[model samples]
Target: MKKTIFTIACILSLNIFNSCSEDIIDLKPPYEEIIEDAIKSEEDVNKFLMGTYLKISSTSLYGSNFFFYGDLLGDTFFRSNKNFGGYTSLIMMNYDPINTGDINFYRSAYDVIQNANFVINNELTDSQLNKQYKAEARFLRAITYFNLLNYYAASPKSGLNQDIGVPIAVYPYNPDEKIARSSISDVYKLIVEDLNYAIENAKAETTSKIYITKTAAKLMLSRVYLTRQQNGDAQLAYNLTDDIINNSPSSFKLFTSTTKDAFKNYFSSSEDIVAENQPETIWELDMNVLNNPGVNSSLSVFYSRTGSKRGLLAKQTFYDSFGTSDVRRDLFSFTSIPVEDNPKGVWMAKHERAAQPGGNYTRNNKILRFSEAYLNRVEALYQLGKNTEALTNLNEFASLRNGSAYSGGNLLNDILSERNKEFFGEGQRFLDLKRYNLPINKGTNCPGNCDVPAGSKYFVFPFSEGQLIINPLAVQHPLW
Candidate 1:
């Protein structure tokens, strides 16, 4: 299986190289033909990793949709009246499996998996650089697998480990061959296996946080375990996040200050978030003027008040949920005068680009951040029955954000609400709602289909019809 996979990977990689050289001028292809010669030195391996990283950041997947998909699916973001340009189907729960090209995240993810497999299956371990390259590939493969499962399958918490996840494609790409989807638990096991290897060995020393590291892998591990919600998984989550929190104290502090402009600075200055100056940023997808998701697909187009679409907005009730003293609420701004004879309830300005419409979208897509590690730990501790410890961590983080500390109440509800506030526009609420299998009580404010009531099929997205046609054994999601 390994030999067959490796041989096919070479072909797939050559095709990837050819597409770049022949069509895309901006991405310079690596020198003269064939696998071994092009990959003779360490420089060759670095080039492949960088190319794969760019591919993963494509707008279809992480570059844009995946982030907001989290918001649109959850209670946080929904289409405002008269604004139906972006994610209307998702917010309205109207997915069409037949509209294959636009909605599917399959190809982009599999492309990365294939590219990463090329690096992994090769005997790239003769030198230190080669081993590091292998580790980097492992990290990317793990990250892709994690997201794939999130979209295609139900969480164990929701489905008791019996849901179908996307196919395991880590071996290699073969157009003739088809691998059936694995159970959610099985896919998670592979994700953990790859991430564990990365946790122990991947340094990612030369690359910026854009590349995954021990800390990033640990954060991912913490999430996976927390979602599983088993006794052992919860403990693992606690241990993993505790190490990241305690060991890297200064390296991962939250943005806090005396003035109300505390969290504002993190988003107000585009440089702070995208340039890696903010301490909270663990791993962020780099976007710049020269290289970015084209203006039409840029993430900025959705969140900015004056963005291209600005289809979604923070609900007034959601806005009122925040305390007056909370610095986080300042991240939003409503058009009180009414753009189309109707005012929108403050689109999230958390993604301000300073020079947005004129410049290419330089808004960095944050993959993992330090603040999440705190939330992950608090959730784990709370689940472990260590309410005191969980509340302490929660209060500490809340205090830093200018919110009142918990004197003593329902920690879980408080934590959930805080997640809604802190991660607004960063995309998190959806999965939590799915994992808990709770109705998306969009309250009285939502304009359409707000109630994602119990046992909703919209919880998981449809596999594209093109995918179903190609892979005969694959099943379409029930909702579609």
Candidate 2:
């Protein structure tokens, strides 16, 4: 279980892409440290693992763009005219290999994966704590890989191109080595493997939502299975969620209060929950006053009315889709301040302002939550032909949120629509659309070019030209 840590011989060369006209902004590499035998004990592994978590929370990954693109590319939000020209490529669905944000995401994700690989490959100590640290590292790597695959590779169900996926790194990064894109099937294989290992060896959910736990691993793996939809995968996903809802510890269940204040307080709470509270977040990135991603990349910056760079506004159509009785609708409110084109607009209130001087609007990035368990299970049940069970679960979840009861007709669509209402700003829609092979329809909010055809190659983002040049074996996505 021990291995020699090798020194990095060369600095990885990355093309620093920047074009203000194209709305591209440069980002720093996540890690510049040399790997050594520094990680020789459980404490060392713990420290490095924490670094990996910090890297994964970068704006290019989960903290901002990763989640924002999910809603931006989907139908939830549009680029407001009062806005400057930042992130225009994402909203317009026109990006190439040289786009800085895309490149940043690709590189940052790999950087995190490399760190996780370092932890996983080396036996820092033969202690039980070391085993848990490795498990946590594997969980981080799996989630990173899964997110990479979502953008870099076509969905397994997309039927467009499924052969090429992002490169899989299981060992410490070596700059001199050129890596090729693994097959999509192979990439998912490694993700599932890592997650399964974490589920077996990682600690259970306790008082922390910031750390990955067995419940988080199980929830993530269920999502993976739900996405793949291979033989018996729906059943597998359903079983995992069922166990979570019924058998997991009380610290990992939903916030099932039906009151408006309860729903509002849940999203706007600036602090992590203690043991006595009903758990909503299964995994979240810790964002505090001391450690905050400043305005430009902060998730709250886009949604908070006080945010100087507030450019993502809710579409009137989407805003109206909420039922009158639904407490979730209260999450959106009018902003009188005129953006570029619009005189006033509605903004999502899910991310509370950690409002600091100098526009450092910040909030914890909620990555996974318990409500998804119901959504995933409901969809899986419908997919498994258990319509009665699916409706029962769906109604239970909806009633808790004060949404009108859904009786019948087109149950799958109902499930998806419910997900849209429940997770509008949380970055779930884009992939949900892809998995279901649905078109991206912007309705009245379309900026000239509205519909991205079902199974379009645009769904599969292109590999950076720099990556293709550096790793000769690396292939650009087809039709990019």
Candidate 3:
């Protein structure tokens, strides 16, 4: 819980990595002075926990790239006319393992994980508040590990626990030591352990969209189970969502209104989007002028039409897939803006900024929401062979979106298609594709060279070249 960044120079020789890649250090505010025995009391533990939240909201971890890559790396997006070669590697369908962007994500996420471990191991205070704080820290740790697994390891359909996963750190880090990658099965064991502890100990007072709570913990656990998709996992996931939906109505109810735009209203800038009014939000990151992720890395800088890069634009085919009456299509930009040699402006209006200065960068991030939980349950119920129940849930959600209801057909494809429409520009498509073992079918909007085969190694990103050289114990993923 110290305010100091845990310098990992002893873990990896910084000289091995080029100047472009920062050597994966866990950084806290250098302006603050270090305090010894800092986390011994409740106040100190609270400050430390605030730092953990900051790490989760960091640009490298969840602020920008994580959200963008969640879709860009999978499909349904293309390097737009705004492509200045920034994310060309991602669009090409073969990532440069040593690219600066990849390195930044890998390092930033691990840094956050290490901080959580530090809190879980320490926090000697026996006070009730401290216990809840430590439990929240553990929940953050579980979420970080889960995201890392999504990027660094193969899906359960591919190898389950047999594939290599990122290192699992459960104690305070010592720079002199280095740890090897754990097996995916081994990594998940710790993840489940942490979440179980969090669910039992997390306090009700800490329940909010910006922080971890029992509901968020349950939702994350259901997501983990859904991804694994084992024999009984679908049933387990369905039950977890059903429990949350049936109870916790005051905390996790979907937004409702008499207005026509109720379904798409939340994405726009409004007072209703706040945690208090937006009970539908399970977790989010607060972003403002003072606490923004800087100019280039700002959340709006990639998706909004005002962004310098404007990285994400719906393909023509994808745009047509949406029903004419569906209001979600209003998020895309149809206006034509010129690019150097590429096509004109095919941008997203969903993430646009306010007209005022600095408003472009000032956007709160929604990490998890109740709508996603609702969709998760639908798929799980379908997988459990409860088609009637699945369709009922699907119809409720679709009607809310003003989209057509599901007729009798392939339940699996119907569930996935519903997810695609509901979660467009929300960074859920890529992982869903992976979960379904679907191919990367690019529309006319994507890069020309991007046509990835199903189950390609490209789907699994590799460690930075510097990581392989610096950490001898760390093994490079195949075909890196």
Q: 17-98, model 2: which lDDT tens digit per residue?
A: 1101111112234534445545555655665676677778777888787778788888777767774457767777777878
- Candidate 1 lDDT, 246-320, residue by residue in tens: 886355655567465656666656564434545777778766664577667777776776666656677777888
Predicted structure 2: lDDT: 0.76
Query: Model 3 segments beyond 4 Å from truth?
Result: 1-36, 83-85, 98-103, 205-208, 258-262, 270-277, 336-346, 355-359
Error of 2 at 1 (Å): 14
Error of 1 at 342 (Å): 6.7
Arrange candidates, best TM-score first. 2, 1, 3
The sequence of per-residue lDDT tens digits that candidate 3 reaches over residues 1-480 is 444435322222222212212322333434323334444556545555666677777787777777777667755666665444476677775565666364367777877777676567663755666678788888888888988888777787775335578787635455556778888878777777787777788854343467778778888888888887777889888877887788764767775442435544566664434323377777777666555677677757777766766556666666777677666766677765435424443566656654345555634677877877788899888778889989998988887766778884877778888888777667778888777666777646665446666677776788877877777576876645
Error of 3 at 208 (Å): 4.8
Candidate 2 ranges beyond 4 A from true positions? 1-36, 98-103, 270-278, 337-345, 356-359
TM-score: model 3 vs. ground truth: 0.87
TM-scores of the candidates are 0.88, 0.89, 0.87
Provide the overall lDDT of each model, using Cα atoms, as 2-decimal numbers: 0.70, 0.76, 0.68
Using TM-score, give the best candidate's number: 2
Model 1, C-alpha of 249: deviation from truth (Å):
7.6
